[model samples]
Target: MSEPFDPARWRPAAFLPERDVRDPALIFAIAVLCFLACLTALGVIAGDRAAHGWSGQLKGEATVIVRARGGETPDAAAARAAETLAGVPGVSEARALEKEKAYDLIRPWLGDVTDLEDLPVPRLVAVSLDRKRPATATVLQEALKAQGVDAVVDDHQIWIKDIRRAAGVVRLSGASIFLLIALAAAAVVAFATRAGLAARRDVVQVLHLAGAEDNQIANLFELRFARVAAISGALGAIAAALTGALLRLIGGGAGITPALPIAWLDLLAVLPCPLLAAIVAVVAARLTARRLIQDL
Candidate 1:
């Protein structure tokens, strides 16, 4: 009588007895890929946060520069411009900036200046616009002109656009890198599968002669590679996560805040890298096995 199937003995690994089925090179390649994938995901998350934060902080805000002209002092013109801006319908607040602060703003370009008083530095007025009733740069400039203050208003919209475009480029580059890594990983897994199949060709021929189906043989290799990929990928992902946490801690110790804020929920992006690696391995191995088996 035929023996009944035993659930305990039905593990997929049992079908593949060759030690070469688990390729160390494949595992190492998969681990490296997973590590890079984790980093890419983190970069995308950070870039997105930084872009949104910059936009939120700079939108609807402007700086008004009052130049001294026609016997008018810069400081007096700045004060008048601030008063005029405050009375504008969409302007929430306008404050005249101190000369010392204005000097500091230009210090990076001009270096330390002991005689900043002699420099023809324009006086600055910081303007805040109400979100519900946003003011246009043209209106603010016209209002200052009406008050006899020769001024230029910079809304910083162009700078914000450039920042967002830079973030988008960063995100696109990271995604491209991630995609290349994934494709390379799949290629590695396929190569390893073929190598294993070559090593066990005799066993495969014997099994076929003994009535084993092609899918049965393919399953053996798939399961073996899937397990190795899962283990190696998990190790790499864990290492990457620990490294990221360590960096955050070190940055905090150095009193450097990250440009992009990290929250607990960001872990979701990092946690799936290993699983994606394993799925790639399994699919590649299965496809390679089936194709090779068909040729046999």
Candidate 2:
């Protein structure tokens, strides 16, 4: 009987360390916070896509209006101008607007646009461009001027500028929200680390006096914290998914619409957020343990 082979001297204490972060309540709280942060991030991503979709779908097409030169019978000049534009190299298809359709467009602003039809609307040609469209506004304008009608190209680029500006603002706002969430997570981790250190103060002191190395003590804290955070993160991500699904169901039932919907794809994209939160918590715990262990 070789002294009964006591293994306590060589092996570290199993689950007897100061921080045994296997608590269910703490884990649940951490998970919930992570899920909320991810939800906000998903909203930001969806907003960005909607802005780009609106801008891209409407860009590159322009409207051309051929106005009569005011003195002569306007029909011949308008037709000649239309014929000239249709033959231009960049112009793919040019169609003169029917009077009814033109009147309908002005109805919103002028009210009873049928009365305004007699007021010269200038023969409007909606121009479609081919792949290798010429830099044709100036060329077309000059050509139309030669044809005795004043022509103007309305390229619709002003809306593009506005859309880009709006998108930039949305991106900046999303960045701000992400930063705030990170700060909140850091704060939570800091608070949790401090509480954990306080709880295990006596255990840490006993271990320090027992000749256990500082690294070993720190390792115990890191392990406990990491395990707790991983469990919490997983729970939080799952809860978040459930909540998002519920909301989507409710919205669908009501036939509600948003510029962007909360889809499973976005939810999947954000699934890693909780895991990142856990990593942040573990790092915070490690740093806290190192400092406190040194003080002891």
**Winning model by lDDT:** 1
Tens digit of lDDT per residue, candidate 2, span 56-164?
6445456776667757434555566668778877777667766566567767878864476467766567766564544356766776777767778776678779988
TM-score of each: 0.78, 0.76
lDDT (Cα) of model 1 = 0.76
> Which residue window of length 10 is worst by lDDT in model 2?
253-262
| Tens digits of lDDT, candidate 1, 47-112 | 677667777667768999889888777788888889999999899999999988789989999998
Best TM-score among the predictions, by candidate number: 1
**Residue 131 of model 1: what lDDT?**
76
Residue 254's lDDT within candidate 1 is 24
- Stretches of candidate 1 above 4 Å error? 1-13, 18-25, 51-57, 68-73, 87-92, 103-121, 129-134, 146-148, 253-264
Q: Positional deviation of 73 in candidate 2, in angstroms?
A: 8.7
